[model samples]
Target: MPSNIPFRPFHRPAPDISATRKPDGSLIVRSNIPLGNYEANIGAYWRAAADRFPDRAFLVKCSPDDTWPELSYRTASEQSDRISSYLLSRGYGPDKSIMILSSNSFAHATLMMGAVQVGIPVTQLSPSYSLVGNDFTKLKYAVELTEPGMIFAEDGNTYAAAFESLDLSDKDVVTISGKDHGGIRFDDLLGPVDSVSVEAAFSAVTGESLAKILFTSGSTGMPKAVPNTHEMLCAAQKTLEHVSESLDAVNDPTRVLDWLPWHHTYGGNVNFFGIARVCGTLFMDDGKPTPGLFGRTIENLKRISPSRFSTVPAAYSYLADQMEEDEELGHAFFKNVKICQYGGAALSQEMFERMQQLAIKYIGMRIPFGTGWGATETTGTGTAVHWDSEKVGLIGVPTPGITVKILPVGEKLEIRIKGPNVHAGYYKRPDLTAQYFDEEGYYCIGDAVKWVDPDYPEKGMIFDGRVAEDFKLANGTWVSTGSLRLSLIDALDPLARDVVIAGHDRDEVGILVLLTEAMQKKYADQPGALSADGRRIVAPALIEAVQEKISRYNQGNPSPSRRVGRALILAEPLSVDKNEITDKQYINQGAVLSNRADLVALLFADDGSGGVIKLNKNNAMKGDKDVRNEQADTA
Candidate 1:
């Protein structure tokens, strides 16, 4: 009943893994493939890429007028050398870190490469911390913690408020524009090039040298500074290249057009550094997955057909909807894309099917959808789903250099990672470092997984849920929040953007859902239907649709731990400043629950108010005052 369209030529060896069981019911899984030799520093890869393809475009900036400015590998290397010489002349080193507060840009990349190549740790903070809120709390916190010697901003005038709020008396403020605000011009740094000094500093860079300090998403709390060493960054990409047979294919440079923020691990360490490793060209995408900005991404796609397309699950949902409607966009998307990759969350079966159908329609073949499982602490990715497959939630086997330890914890197997790529510890926070790593030096990542096939170990693992996120109801029935969340998303496809499960220590589970753009548009005609942010439901018809859908979902998942008893469409979007959402668009379940405790209380109260949609055992949607009153009296 399914189309037997073969996948495009994607060559990667089959998973070769072995496992060792411990006395405490913990299993250590590893790949038989070796990591082999890798570059000493991430900057070395950039140098090699320049040597391989001197005049090839290393980075391309998309423009509205089709004047896409490109920087060649040789030009980038030379400019980076000049920047490195400048930093060296100023006596910048490990202690004098460079902090960048701008979004992804050519100057940002060049500055990062220039600094990291010479052992000066560079910290790239999310622009949201500075530009999103008026308070600038997170920005101040990062400034206080990192204690950077120099701070870089794309525009000093745009971040004038952010700069005024911080103590920059002793720090150097550099900007590409808006120098009137007491900022140093970025162009002035290119006056001289100390070639001998630059070479000596670069040569002294060892595997232990700190290349970058990437901040964690701060989902649960304040962001932790994770120091990434040269070994970690270089080793991660090397393992992927060593294992993925087609990575360095002859005459095929890895070309990717991406918009993932460079502040995050997926964008910075993986995409940026990995592309440089294989002499690849990275087209800088100025757009994002959000509503107003996605048009830019589509425009960029129209001009440059990337070899690999990768993004978050939310972005895929948006793209799939757009491609289904716009034939030209679909054609442009699948024009030369060899693989479509997703991370952050699991893709729904419906979304996956729609993409494959679009691929079949446009490209005559199903492009392989690849995903991996890892975090900032693991450098980038520890496990990868490299093979061609349609199945979602398959995180695949451990990569060549990494080992995954699955330890039994209460009915779930918690995943811990260990490898050369893994971070030694948090930056200057030995307390947090000691708390995360175990006796065997494995970083306890706190994620849970299960075997896809116990008999066949190489079949890979499925994400169960976060071990810390799982909680018990009043009757002590444990709930796997991760699995339940994914199932609920699938059950409410085309309607729910994301669902956060709430019912810790309560009688039953309830879901706080963020509605999709399409769902909001469908109910836009009704007066008082949507909030100003277009997230809430004031219209009765929209509320009823959600109630009916979840009732059907509860029909199939009748178990206490699986079934959601009530639903509430969120009125307010997740707050980035409050740590409710990550830069990669991942909803922090714990942060949401903690910040919106009042909403959780209302979901549990269920006195038929606040647009809470409840369902009874008779499969009846109950929002009527009489029904709720009677139920409340009985309780």
Candidate 2:
């Protein structure tokens, strides 16, 4: 018999909200929580913090050469002032701005802060467009769209091939690496500090001032530039502060170890701006949550324990496993961590439970786990489950000065938001911007969220998949892909890494599961089931695990649309080159469905000696590789 699990105590106060029924039967929910009195721009706080805590470490970088280089607040401030003055002298401002084509570093932070602090809009292009893409098509498009005055990269030599054919006649190109790739040195940007002009420029900045222009992934179509203003970035943080009692932690500089790219909105506004808000000590992490680089992240966590933590769900999954294995890391991670946060995607229920159990074991109490929801147009975080809860995928109420309107679209509740934190519009695309907003001015975010409790709205909302991603079954029964995906992951536990929902217009739902490392290890010698290649593997054990779980789930729910009829453990993993996955490890549903339509057919087909396993209450014909023999052998 299982013991009763106590409610994990989560006590951050809920934001004030009011829900009104619209004339068209839609619901408009608004939060009355008051925002903090933030400065005119994000950099103002940085400037003040430097003055107050002059010698405190601002940005620390741990390089491959075993060099841990750091810049104090005072030094960073002075350098930024010099850089700002030089940019001003060279006539760089809102219209004539700078574009950074480098990965995140100490220089990237200062340059971005210096330019944006003094009203020079900065456009940081994603390194993927240059480094990862085969043709550099997106980079070419971005350059043509922005037509920036200056372009800066960490090393000119590294980006030589990317910038070679690009037209940079009127543009100033600068690099920190001094490799002499027909560009000015980063040191050249450090000139005499004209305090009078710099101060005036900072003071003159307003909410309307353009701080940055970030491009979308361009997976669906040509990328659209989202213009984020100072008000948008600053107001976003203020609203975030309202929902979170953790603002108390903001008074003391936050110690963070993060790797989210500066080009991404979550990295720039939520992670980066959140640190700068309190003059936090940021240890720039060089590794990601992916297979090869996560070791670097583990090494960092083994040493520098953060006061608070923010990372994607995939990273947390990897970290949670490491913590269980490494006792020293487990203790250090929970020692000073007040809040553990995740974004980009929903945290799996197993991962959420794993972290809480580890926290209880290590810290004697559960550390608060938070997941925020928003988009590029929202300037970063919007709804945050600021409370301490073990529950996954619950995106809480709107932050202060923001309203969320939920309209019924087909079978899902479409969530829309409007507030100070919201972006003004897409850059140079007034027509597209106009179409995205409703008459009431709420930006249609295309997400579907259902309230956790119908009677009590303060509890929070559960994200049902994206409206655009959802498709109706043959019998017209709508499947909530996001909700169902979470259920499958939970039921399958460690076996299901990430799943793509199949049977869009079919009789029943199916799944394409990306197997876990543990699963891969278990079947290392099995030739037919598991392969050595990291990309794709067909595993009978994978199908066996999923079938048992789905059967258990079907006995409870008894809904055809919610059932996982068949499953295929692919021999190949989703590739970034194929545009199947995002930087945050989120699978692009459309891209996957479009690229691998053949694999999807095998799930529904009668005969699949081809690795697809039929596992359903509804009659999906059993393949020769049925788990009856495989299951007994494993047992």
Candidate 3:
């Protein structure tokens, strides 16, 4: 637990919730607070924001030389109106959707709003689909599913190969720069506005009207297109607003620096529209949480001290590593930030304490660190941690206008959500739509949760691991991979970036560890750092450290379900093309395991190959005499 330092105050609404036990022992949770009237159309909020804060900067981005170029609300409105007119003149309507292949940018923001306001559904695909791989399989899948009438990319020359691979003969290609393949310049879209036509289209928009089509990360299989209606997006923002009363929003200086890709729900629906709903400024961060790219995020944080910092847990780990060594960066990041939030994965308790300690040291009070639970199927977040707390891993309670049902599944309680913010169905995939929902119309989210306090249901729920990720050993002992992964991450701390649990049908558990960049760099100069084949890192100290940590963990958790019996260090990076990793840096456990079945086999082979570390039945350290530097294939 963190020290007794007082938490910084934010006007967050208290958790007002109630629960009812069903006849079958299922628990239904609902928020007592009512969700008042909200905008039925997303465009209406844009108009209201533009009218109120016309001169205020709504979107900001970094130039090559580190200058911030901003787009004011009024300017964005005028340009979007022009874009709406141009789109309408070209006969693009609800069915003739546009596909955006670019990342988060001011231009992308304006174009999305422009098209959606006038009834043209826009599809945002991960740039990794186009730029990261040679096959472009996911990109082709998305194009075939959406059958878009137009495509937009930031640079035509950069994405020319991707466009060439796709059959875009009848589709229009729009680009901001590099006029390759006879593409239409994005600036050309800014034409004269037809107010009467635009007004008619805007007025015709309803809650059921399609606004955007977002694709899943394709971790399980081919990406499924999720339809975002005007009602879903608007109501989600309203629920978010009612949950967290931002001081920044009230003071008129709410600024956010974010790098989560706009293709995902967290970035696309929440951060993008949620910021706009509050009339706040979003500084589009181009940096990612990778080794060579995270420095750009640090530089952005140094320049723009935002009021709120929301990102994934992996990014927070990188930020913690940076802030621990760099005092100036820590001071700058904690200067104006009121709340720190995370989602997409569980944050380790060690990380939460470290961040709160840093906040107390620099800011005189601990800034409230929070998290929420949601998915692409749900508009954004159905439940959130809205109160001040010193603990981590609590997903809070149901937000207004949402209901969560907790049904017992084996030893875990599976969570299902029903709300106005939930999407109707997947685009053009009736089979998938029918398969995911229950007879009661609640979407089965496949996640498990437990009440913080069974007696006091208002305390919210703690995230138990994913129901599908859990697997039983050969002995029939079920292992909760979600909780186990977090435990391994906390145990490995600065050495391992992530660990994928192997051994589903085996007698015991094993882990494939992805080493942190610092760990690799720190041991690169040491003797015996590289394996005999120069494929894996076999530093004696690194291996010894890992063995000792896992040994201690094994001692602490002796059960077969929790104890790790063997471990292997993986050298290859997770591939975006293979769906092993998302753009937000979240590892897809199923994808990684299936994609690297050889590694999983090597982990359980017991031959001591590939620098495999093993522990005796009594949790004693196994001698490393046979732990050889076995060469393995890389993805």
Residue range 229-334, candidate 3, lDDT tens digits: 9989988988998888754454656889888888898898988888778888888887877877778988899888888998877777788888989999999999
TM-score of 2: 0.93
- Tens digits of per-residue lDDT for model 2, 93-189: 8888889998888788889988998999999988877777557888888888888998888887788778775887888888877465665898888
TM-score of predicted structure 1: 0.95
Which residue ranges in model 1 land beyond 4 Å of their true spot?
1-3, 180-183, 245-251, 531-535, 624-635
How far residue 108's Cα lies from its native spot in candidate 3, in Å, is: 1.4
**Residue 467, model 2: Cα distance from true site in angstroms:** 0.8
Off by over 4 Å in 3: 180-183, 246-252, 524-527, 532-535, 628-635
Which wins on lDDT, candidate 1 or candidate 2?
Answer: 1
Clashing pairs in 2: 535-572, 535-573, 536-571, 536-572, 537-571
Per-candidate local distance difference test? 0.85, 0.78, 0.85
Every model's TM-score: 0.95, 0.93, 0.96
lDDT accuracy of residue 584 in candidate 3 = 74
Clashing pairs in 3: none
**Candidate 1 residue-wise lDDT, 86-168, digit = tens:** 99999899999999999988899899999999999999999988898888888898888889999999998898899988888
Model 2 misplaced stretches (Cα beyond 4 Å): 1-11, 63-66, 246-252, 521-535, 618-621, 626-635
